[model samples]
Structures are given as C-alpha cells and as structure tokens.
Target: MKAKLGMSPIAWWNDDLVELSDDVSLEECLRQSRSAGFTGMEMGRRFPSDPEVMLPILKEADVTLCGGWFSGTLVNEELAANKDRIEPMIELFRAVGAPCIVYGEVGRSIQGDRSAPLAQKARLDDDEMKAYARKLTEFGEWCAERGMPLSYHHHMAAVVETEDELDAFMNHSGAGIPLLLDVGHLVFGGGDAMRAIDKYHARINHVHVKDLRLDVINGLDRTKQSFLDAVALGAFTVPGDGSLDFEPLVKRLAEHGYEGWFVVEAEQDPKANPPLKMAEVGYKELMRIMTAAGYTVETQGFPRG
Candidate 1:
C-alpha cells in the first residue's frame, strides 16, 4: 500500500470561509483543507467546475484533487442528455489526473412521502444499469487511454447499494470499472460495509470515509427518503462521532491491500461549531481510529495558521 492520506475538502458543511458556504472557492477550501492535513478533496459542483480554473490554486495549496461524486440519473436518464453532464466531468477528472468520479444510484421519489422503505423505492434497473455500465465502460476506456479510472459510487440510491444489489450489478457491470466504496453511504442499506469492501477488493480503487449514526439511519429509514435527501436530513459525520467500528473497517481494508485516500466526509453544521475546531476533533478521531486498528501513522495534526 502506498503511503497516502485522503479526505474530502468537503464543502457541504465547512464552518470556516463563507466563500465556500455555497460556491466553495478553491483558494479558500485549499487553505482550510491543507491546514486540516487533508491531502485532497471530492470536487463538488461549485468547485471551479473547470480544471483550467482550479489547477493553479490546487498547486499553490499543495493539495491533490482527490476526485468527486457527480449526481445524475445514469440508468433512468437518456444517454444523450446524460452524456452532456458526464463529458465535462470526464474532462475535469482528466485535467486533474484523478483516478475516478463518484457516480450515484439512479432513482426518483415522491415529495413528502418518506414512510415507505427505501429498498422498495430505490433499486438497480438491470436493463438500464447494463446500458449505463457500458456507457461507463466506454468512458473508462476513454479515460484509460489517458491513464485514469471511473470509480462508480455504489450509493444507497444507485443500483449497487446493498451487498446483494452490488453482487448482481457487478455481475453485469463494473468489470473494468473502479468503485468508490463509501462506508457511511454503504451502511444505509444495512449492508455489512466490510463485506462489501472485501467483495469488491479488486475493483475498489478509491474511498470516501465517513461514520454514520444508527439512530439517524433508523430515523431516515422511517422517513423513507432517498439517500441524497437524507444527506440534507443530516445522516453522516466523521467516524468517531458516530457508531461505526472503524477498527475492523481499516483492518479489513488493510487485508485487501487497499491504498488511497481515507477521505473524511462529515456533512454537519460546521457553522454551529467552528470549522477549525471541528477539524481538530476530526484529526484526533482519525488518529484514534487508525491507532485502534493497529495501523501506525505519522503523528501529524493539521497545521494551524
């Protein structure tokens, strides 16, 4: 395994730098991210959206572009329209030399009706998933020509959320594609997060490390809201703040020879708690989790300005 640390310069709930409050400025985010010991970040929609615009700022901050998750209905949407969205994303990833772009599960939901089970509402459209998988294969091939990979995020909403769903989806898709195994997002479907990692060990290339609250998960299950909708409902946070046992999580990853960024993805009220303060807490938690798993790491804390 290569020696590298990964974290999301997650702007979703960053409490510092109001410029990143919505259209997160790269310059501002890089400063904060670098300060927090973040080696990289998941590019959001507002993150310059153009490599030409962000490349210089990234170099100045000495932060690598970890990659990003793109939101769109791949299985359900028309390929022509979907391509319009994917093409630019591919271009951006190419420019940054990112390994993959995290893509989501495809589904639609009713407004205010959050009582039905999500498993009932969200699912992988086999026929559609196959087509989209081929599209991704083509895209991956295109990226491969340039030495990149497509890490399709098997999100709770996407076709590959559950272990069973992932098994089936992988049977047909993901053969040549890499997958972003997000622990927090993966747990929503009640999937054994570690098992999923082991199953996709070969194809697993990137990660979005996060912790989840069982109470929050149960609450969202009661509402039956989609995964993205639940994000707005505050379902995720840094590992130690939640109930996940990251000890074995990291252990399992190590067993599989997993190497890459362990992107810290905590979408909480950063404004309520100062961003710098939250980062302090996050760094300690990551260290604790890593240590508990018996993995030794440099005792580095985010450099404070």
Candidate 2:
C-alpha cells in the first residue's frame, strides 16, 4: 500500500500551550520539517486561512498540506451552528486538497484546561453516545457532500477517550463518520492500538503516529494532573524515543491494507526536545517500519484520499 509521511506543526509551535512552542515562523517550521524528510505537514496556528496565501509558503518548502485539527462541538451544539463554524475550514481544506479534516470533539473536552485533572474528563453514557454518534454521522455526511470528509479524532481528555468509549461511539455511528486513529492517545488512555486497529481498520481514514513516554504517563497522577500537565511532564515523544514498537503496528496496518497519511504529532517542549531532531527521529523510524510493512512511502507529495 502507498503511505505518506507527514508532520504536525504542533511539534514546532503548539497552539494550546504556547509556552511549549519554539520561537519560529511558519516558513522556518516548514523548512525544518522538510529537512527531516517529511513531504507533508498539517496546518497549525501560524498557517494563513487563505489557500492562495498558504500555497506559496508550502510550495517553497516542498511539502503538501496533509490534514489538521478542527475543534468540533457537534456533541453540545446545534448542527446549524456547528456548520457555520466549520464552513471556513471546509472551504480551506477543499481548496488545499487536504485528505480529511481531523475533527476533535472539544465540546466538553478538558484537554486544554491546565487545572482540570484527567479524572475530570467528559463522559457520555450509551444513550448520549447514540445521539452524539448520529449527529457526527450526519455532520460527516454533510462535510463529504461539500467535498471533504471528517475524520473523527478520539482524543485524550475528550468525550470519546478510552477503548470502551471509542467502541461505543463507533458502534452507534454510521460509515459516514470516519475515524482518525491516534495511537499514542489510545495507548495513553489505556486502550490497545493493536486491538483498535483490528476492529476499526475499515473506518479509520487517517492516522496520527504519536508515540508516548510510558514512564511519564505511568507516573502521572491522573486524579491531580491535567492533560496539559502530563504534556509538560513529558508524556509524549517521537517514535523511536518512546516506548512503542511501531513495527508491529505498521505491519498490522499493512495487513489491513491501510493507505493514507501517517502524521507524526508529538507535541512537547521544543526547547527540551528540539523539533528538528525529534522530527528526524520520527521520520527515520517511520520509514524503517513502513518499509518493513511493505508500504511504498510517498516522497514527492501526499495522495488525496
């Protein structure tokens, strides 16, 4: 299968935690990412909303726009209101030829709250999940009809966090709502990436190749520490620097015939773990695993799914 390697700008310039970000321009971020051998990058806070203005900067760096995060509120807000909020992103993604928009359900999310402990994360029972999933399916279908699809991101402190929650969400949702499997977040939340991949392979439209510092995660006091606190304590890292053995996961993806962008999205203090160094580590490790898994890694540009 054909796979493309991409990098998220979070590693260079974090949006949620600006303190963790490196002092760099968008051009420099793209330059460093391309230097590390990534052919594509996800949109970040620094990226211009206008595609006409953005395309030249990306072109100069020899990278394509892969995918980016969208803070979605479909769970708590009306469809019309959500539609209005997402219209600009939909137009931007469509204009840039991005594969899919990463829809992170941040309606009731505590991920950005530095004081909110991990234990206080939002939750929804079966009935609530059913309604939320239905709404997501409808929203996903609407986005697809407008020329892009939503890849639902099951995030760290979001509503659909653990394996059970993800299962419940997927069970209730239709094919219209595709999935974005973020392995690090899944594993950090006590979910097995291997098991998730086995079950949700068909629905997974995008992949985040995030790796974790298991020691940090294991040591964190979830009852006292928030998601951002865990991040500050160095909970996440690039592939080879972390505890995950990505070879097995990549092999599993290859077995499932997965073909899409595998974006390296390790957001940490750039001063501590320099973005360029970490990006190279992630790129090399993914390359080795992708080759081992029989994937032809695309170098020139990303393929539109």
Candidate 3:
C-alpha cells in the first residue's frame, strides 16, 4: 500500500487566523509547496471556489488537489441543510479529481475561540454521541454516492477530541464513515497516536502527519488557553522539528497496509517558521521515515476505493 505525501496550506496561511500569512498569494503557496517536494496539497481559504479557476493554477505548479476541509454542523443542523451546504464543495472536489473530503465537525466547537479554554471545549453526552455518529454515517453515505469518501477529522476543541471520545464516535459511526487520523492532534489532546492507529487502522482512510512540541504542550494551561492560542505559541511544527517519533507510526501504517495522503499540516506563524523551509524539512523527514519502514513514497496517483 504505497502512500502519497501532501502538505496543507495552513502552514503557509492559517484559515482560522487570516492575519497569519494574509499577504501570501495562492500561486506562491502552490509554487512553494511543489518546490518543497509535495505533489499535492489540501485546499485553503485563498483557493478559488471554481475548479476551472483553481485547476489551471494547480496544473501550472504540477500539483494535485488532494482534498479540502469541510466544516460540518450535523449535530445542530438538519441533514438536508448540511448536505446542501456541502454539495458545492463536493462538486468542486469532483471537478478537480480530489480523492476525498475532510470533514471537521465544528458544531459548537471552541477551537477557534481564543477566549475559550481548551479544557472547556464542548462535548456530547452518551446519547448525543450516538446521535451525532448516526448523522455522520448518513452524511458519509451521501458523500459516497457522489464518488467522494467522507474522512472524519477528530479535531481539537471539537466534540470528538479525546481518545475515548474518538473511540465512541468511531464505534458508533457506521462503517461508511472513515477516520482521518491526525497524529499531532491526538498527541496534543493527550492520547496515544500509535495506540489509536492500532485500534482503528481499518477505519482510517486519510492521515494528517503534523508533529508536536511536547515541552510547549506540557507547559500549556488547558483551562486558560484555546487551541488557537496553542498554535500562536508554537505548539505544533513539521515532523522533524518537533518531539514526535514518526518512525513507529509510519512503520505501523505501512505494516497495516494503510494507503492515502499523509499530509504535513502544521498550523503556525509563517513568518516565524518559514513555510517553504519547514515544508521541505517535513517532506524529507517523512520520506526518510517511510523509506526506513520499507514503504515506497509514490509521488503520483491518487488512492481509489
């Protein structure tokens, strides 16, 4: 199961905090991503909604549109309304030939709220958990009907942040819904990333390979700081620059036959970290780890069901 490597545009320009890298152009982002050795990238706020407008730019840089983040409010909104909002993004992905759409359940999420503490993030009760999972399953099925698989992102400050929360969601959610295992978030949220892969490997169809700085994470007061606050403080970084050990996770993914995009996604200040340099570092480190794990890093071809 060969995997393709991709980078997220959040490294160049953060979606939540537009002020970070607001001056960087979409062309420069794509160009620097390609130059850093990533063949593809996830969509960003700077990207055009129209595929015809975006595809030409991507083609010029010789990069593929791997996927894009879709904010889902399934827990609060009606399924029909959620579907209606997502249909256009789904169409855009289909037009650009993206393999999947990354779904982040942002209903009542405080990840973006600088004043809201991380520890006080909203969580669902047992019954609410089951209902949310059911809605997620239905949405996943709807996406599948349109040739796009839904990869659920267990994001920070979301309802499904912790390991037990992730477990409940995965167990209750139907098999049609796939998990997008993000190593950095799992570790940052005080969960074992490798253990998660071991338990949920079969359901994981997409991957986000950001690394965490444990020193910064250990010092953070979850009761006072939000997820966005942590990002501003440099709690996350590319693979080699952080405290995470990627070899074991990479080897496990290869051994389990996990195939898809392993995107390097570190939400940080571009001025401080330098997007192009950090991207190259991430690309090289991941390649080294994957090679050591006896997996060939394929630079072409998207994963298919």
Candidate 4:
C-alpha cells in the first residue's frame, strides 16, 4: 500500500488557542513543514480561501492540500443549515483537490472554551445519536456527491468524545459518514485506539497520527481543567518524542489495506516545542513505521538530496 505524509498547521498557529500560536506567515509555515519532510499540509486560518491565491503558495513549497478541519453543527442544526455552511468549504476543497474535509461536531462542543471543564463536554443519548447520525450521513453524502468527501472527526470535547460515544455514533450512522481516526484524541478520551481500529477500519477514510504526553493527560483534573487547559499543560506531542507506539498501529492499518495520508497533527505551543523540529520527529517516526508496515511512502518532491 502507499501512504503520504502530511502535517497540520495547528502546530504553527492554533485556531482555538491563539496564544499558543507562532507568529509566522503562511509561506513560512509551508516552508518549515516541507523542511521537516512533509509533502502535504492541512489548511489553516492563515490560508486564503481563494484557490487561485492558495495553489501557487502550495506549489512553490511542493506541498499538496491534503485535508482541513471544518467545525460542524450537525448535532443540533438541520441538514439544510449545515449544507449552507459547508458549501464554501466544499468548493474550496474541490478546487484544491483535497482528499477530504475533516468534519468535527462543534454544535455543543466546549473544546475552545478553556473555562468549561472537560467533564462538561456534550453528551448524546442513543435516541439523540440516532437523529444526529442520520443528519451526518445526509451531510456526508451531500459533500461526497460534490466531489469532496467529509471525514467525521470525533474530537476531545465534542458530542462524540469517548469510545462509547463513538460506538453509538457509528452504530447509528451509515457508510455515507466516513470516519477520521485521530489516534491521539481516541487515546486521550479514554478510548482504546486498537479496538477502534479493529471496529471502525472499514469506515476510516483518513488518519491523524498525533502522539500524546500521557503524563500530562494523566495529571489533568478533568473536573477542573478544560481541553485547552490540558493542551496548555502539554498533553500532545509528535510521534517518537511521546508515549504512543505507532509501529503496531501502522502495521494494523497496513494489514487492513488502509492507504492515504497519515498526517502529523499534534497541537502544542510552538515556542515550547517548535513546529518544524516536532514535525521532523513525527515524519521520521512515521517513515520508519510505514516502512515496517510495507508501505511505499509517496514523495511529492520531498526528501530531496
């Protein structure tokens, strides 16, 4: 199988926690990520929506627009409203030739609110999940028909936060709603990443290879601290520099014939853990794991000698 290496722009500049960001231009961000051996990058706030304006900057760095996040409100809103909101992003992703748009449910999410405790994350009973799943399926189908797919991201402080929530969502949702398997978030949310891979492998269309600092995760008082607080305490990191063992996960993914972009998406303070350096660590580790898993890593003019 073939796999591509991508990096998220959050490492350089966070959208939710602006204070954790590095003051850098979009060009510099792409250049640094490319220097770290990534051939693709997810869109960030600094990125211009106009493909005419964005494509050249990406081409200059020899980087592909792999994927990007979209804060969705499908949990409480109607499908029509969600459609209206996603239209522009769908057009942008289609123009950019991105694989998928990472759709994270933020209708009842407290991820951005540092004041809200982690335990206060939104919850959905089975009946509520059933309705939300139906809406998500319709939305995902709509996005896919438009030539841009939607990969549902089960986030840290969203409605579908824990393993049980994910199971509920997946059990109710159809094949139309594809999954974005964020290993770090799954692990941090007290979910078994391996079990999730085993169960949801067929639905997983994209991957986020974010590593976590277990010490920080364990130390966090979920009742008092919020998701952003945990982030501020250094709960996430790049692979090979943190607690995750990607070899098994990559091997499992390869075993299931999973192929596509494996993105490095650890969100941390750029000043404390420098995006470029952390990206390098993530890229190298993914390279090793992908090789061991018999994956041919795609090179979009990267690792140049």
Candidate 5:
C-alpha cells in the first residue's frame, strides 16, 4: 500500500481563471512539477487531449497522468446527457492509464461567479438529494464499466458542500460511488477534513491535499465574496504553509489502508506564489507526513536525469 505523490497544475496555471498564467507553457508546467519532486500530475486545461502528443511529453518528464477535474451537471441534466460529456474524458483517462475521474457537480454552482455571494450557493432538499445520489451512482457504475472509477469532488458553492450534505449523498448513493476527499474544500465549506477521512475512509478513492489560509478564510464576508474571489485573495496554499494540520489526517488515512494519489492542489496566483517553489513546499510537507505515518512515498515514474 505505497502512496504516490502528485500535484495539480492549478498552482501554476488556473483553469478557472485562465489569465492567471496565460503565458506559462504546458511543457514548463510538467517540468516544474517533476523538478519539484512530483512523480505524477493531474491534467490541466492547456494539456493536449491527443494521447500520442501528451504521453510523450509526460514520458520526457517521467510523470504519470493522475487525472483531471470533470464538471458534472447530473443534478439538473439527465444521466445520458451527462454521460455524453464525460465519456470522451473517460476514454482519454483510460488510454493514459489514469486511476480515476474527478467529478465535480457544477450544475447551478456559483463558484466561478465572482460577483455572486458564497452564501447564495445552490443546495438540494432531501428528495433532490436522493435523486442526485441515484444519478451519481448510475454514472459511477458507467465509469467503472469503462475501466475508470468516478471520484465525486464536493466543492464550495456547489449543491453538495456541507458535511451534512456529504453525509446524505454518501448514505443515499450506491456503494460503488467513491469519494474524492479534498481537505481544503471540505474546510472551506465548513466541514471537518479529518472527520471526513475517518468516516468515509472506506469509500475514498482519490485525495486532494490542499491547505487553506484560515486567517483569510475567517475574515471573508460570505455575503460579498465568491469562491473565485477567495482564490484571488490567496485563500489556498501548500499543506505546510497553511493553517490546517495534515499529520493526523495523513496518519488517519494510512491507518484506514488508503493507498492512492495525494494530489497537492492550491489554486493561487503564480506571481504571488511561484509554482516551482510552492510545488517543492507541498511535496516536502506531504513526504514528511507520509513518512512519519509509516507510509512509503512511491517515486516510481519520476525522472532521474
């Protein structure tokens, strides 16, 4: 049960805010990730879709393609329609040997609406929750049939953001549907990350080890600022540089026999926090926590030269 370390390109180039690092090339992102000691990296918007083109670049950097975010609208759209949107990405992930597809429900989400208040984000009632869970389960099974697992990402400003909502989804969803436990989003959404790991340990197939700047978070006016606004204000950072403690949470995951990609994702302005430096900070902190927890940090695909 060796755990592998990976990183998100968001720290370097934000997919939501394309202007963050519009000039940074895809080659540079992969290079910086590998140089920062990440053996794997999740795909970004700039990444080539053709496997023949992307695989070679990945091989040159010696980094594995972990996966990328997939915005799902199952809460409002039909499963068949959503399948059409997800199937192509599934094919790409399967071709590249990725482990799972990170699914974030964005139907009626205000995360990207900078002018929209966070408190006005969408939410589902009990009946709507059950319906959404059923649709998610069906989609998860569809992915499993295609050789990829669907990892549900609970995000801020989305319908399923709070701990109670997360619990309801898990309780109602089929056993096949797995969770993508994202620590920073959980905290930002007013949920306990450690408690989530402990409670949903058995169903968590993917992990996003993002840390939050609590001082900034505490000072946020939810009625005025949106999730995107928070990101612009430097709300997220590498695990060690932020306020959240990862040691106990890491240990808890290890104790629960969780072995998967622990991706470091901090969506920040690259000018304020250099991507390479922040990548190093995240890699070092994750390695330290994993090592202290008695989990082997696998570096199999990393380039030596």
Candidate 6:
C-alpha cells in the first residue's frame, strides 16, 4: 500500500496564542505538512468550513484534501430523515472537490434505562444490519452520482463498533462502498483491528492512522465515561508512540493493494508541549514502519549518505 501520509491541523491550534477566533494560520499548517513530506491533508473543520476560503489554501499548499469527517448520532434507530441529514454534507464535499467523506453511522443507543431498571445495551441483529446496509447503499449510490464516496467510518459509539456488530455492519453495508478504517478506534472498541484489513482489504478507501494506549482504555469506567471522554483522556496517540504492531497492519494493507492516504490524526494537545516534536516522532516512526514493510515515501531524488 504505497500510500501518502497526511496530517490534520487541529494540533496547530493554540488556545492562548489566539482567541481561536477570526483567523488561524492555515498557511503555517500547510507549510508544516509539506515540511513533513506529506502529499495530502485532512482539512481541519476550523480551518475553513466554507469552500471559498479553503480551496485557495489547499491549492497553494499543493496538498490534496484527503476527505473530511461528518459525524452524526445514530445506532439504535433506523436512518430516518436520511436524505435531509446527508444532503448538505454531500454538497459540501462536492463543493470542495473532495473525492470522499469519511463518515460514521450513529443513532441513539437503547439504554435498557430507556425504561431504566435493567438497562443493558441491546444488539443489532442481522435483519437490522441488512436494513442499515440498504440505507447506506442508497446513500453511496447518491454520492456516486456526484463522484463522491461516503466511506463508512466505524466509530466507537456506532452500531458497527464491536466485533459482532462489525460483522453485521459488513454483512449488510453495501459491497463496493469504500470503508475508511481507523486502526486505533477499532482496537479501542475491542475488535481485532487487523483481521478485517486482511479479510476485506479490497473495500478500503482511506485510513485514519491513529494509535492507542490499551492501558488507558483498560482503566476506563465502562459505565459512565463516554467514548469521547476516553479519547480526551489520551487513549489515542500517533503511531509508534503506542502499543500497535504496524508490520502486520501494513503487510495486510499491502496484500490487499490499498492505495489511499493514511491520515495521521492524533487528538492530543500539542501546545502542552510542542507540535513539531511529536510530529517528528510520528513521521520518523511512520517511515520506519513503511520502510520495514518495503514501502518508501517516493523520495525526492536527493540520494542518501
């Protein structure tokens, strides 16, 4: 999988440096990404929510927009108001010329507490999975008309999180719809993150290269803390800084012939320290992993010492 590495600029924000208001140095972020040798980037939501402002920046940076993310809450309900929900996002992606949108399926969860005395979360059976797939397939077809792919992102709060749920989601979600797999989230959600990579490698459209700290996850209060809280607590970090085996991960991707972007997204505060240092750590480790797996960064012809 000779993929380009891209970074998200959320790490570039400094709460104190700027009120995080009128302007953000999007150009500085592009410089950082180019400096890091990435060929593409996942534009930050704050960078430019409107295409008019963002298009020029992306063109100037010479980086491709490796799809943006749109999150919604749906897991326990059938996708109602589906068109109303996704249409704007479809238009947004089309307006910006992004080839795809890394998306997650979420709905309200059925807390046994919906009545309260018992409250154990229920599961989605195969029938529901198929229905969900049909709905997703419809969306994919719609996006296809516009040359945009809605790559289903399997997130923690999603019905497609656990292994069984993952199986069901795959079983039902339309085939040929590209999947934007996130390694860290899969591991956090207690799924064998690499198994699917090897099994359904052909459906992969893009990837979010997030790494996890199993220890942090293992310590969570399984009942109260929301998935977002866990992420906020540093459960995720850039690859190589955590406990994940990239050799097999990459091998499986290569075996499947994946040619997409591995966008490195670490939801940590860079200001607590320095963004570049962590980025350096991330870039070096990413290169090491790629090199070990025999995938080079298509080096810019200045031979080495």
How does each model score on lDDT?
Answer: 0.64, 0.93, 0.89, 0.91, 0.89, 0.67
| Residues 1-305 of candidate 4: C-alpha lDDT, one tens digit per residue | 99999999999998888889999999999999898889999989999999899888888898999999988998888888889988999998888789999998889999999999999887888799999998899889988999998999999999998999999999999999999999999999999999999999999999999999999999989999999999988899889999999899989999998999999998899999998899888888889899999999988732233
- The positional error of residue 223 in candidate 1, measured at the CA in angstroms, is 4.9
Worst 10 residues of 4 by lDDT: 296-305
Please give the lDDT score for candidate 1. 0.64
Error (Å) of candidate 2 at residue 276 is 0.5
How many residue pairs clash per model? 4, 0, 0, 0, 0, 8
Cα RMSD of all models vs. native, in order, equals 4.7, 1.6, 2.0, 2.0, 1.7, 5.5
- Distance (Å) between predicted and true CA of 73, model 3? 0.4
**What's the CA error at residue 189 for candidate 5, in Å?**
1.3
Worst lDDT run of 10 residues, candidate 5, spans 296-305
- How accurate locally is residue 300 in candidate 3, as Cα lDDT from 0 to 100? 55
Q: Lowest lDDT 10-mer window, candidate 1?
A: 11-20
| Candidate 1 off by > 4 Å | 9-25, 78-81, 106-120, 125-135, 221-229, 291-305
Give a tens-digit lDDT track for model 3, residues 1-305. 57788999999888778766647888998889888888888999989999889888888888889888998999788899989999999899999889899999889999889899999999899999999999999999999999888899998899999999999998899888999999999988889999999999999999999999899889999989888889888999999999999999989988898977889999888988899999989999988988898877776533333
lDDT of 5: 0.89
Off by over 4 Å in 6: 12-24, 72-80, 109-122, 298-305
For candidate 5, the per-residue lDDT at 240 reads 87
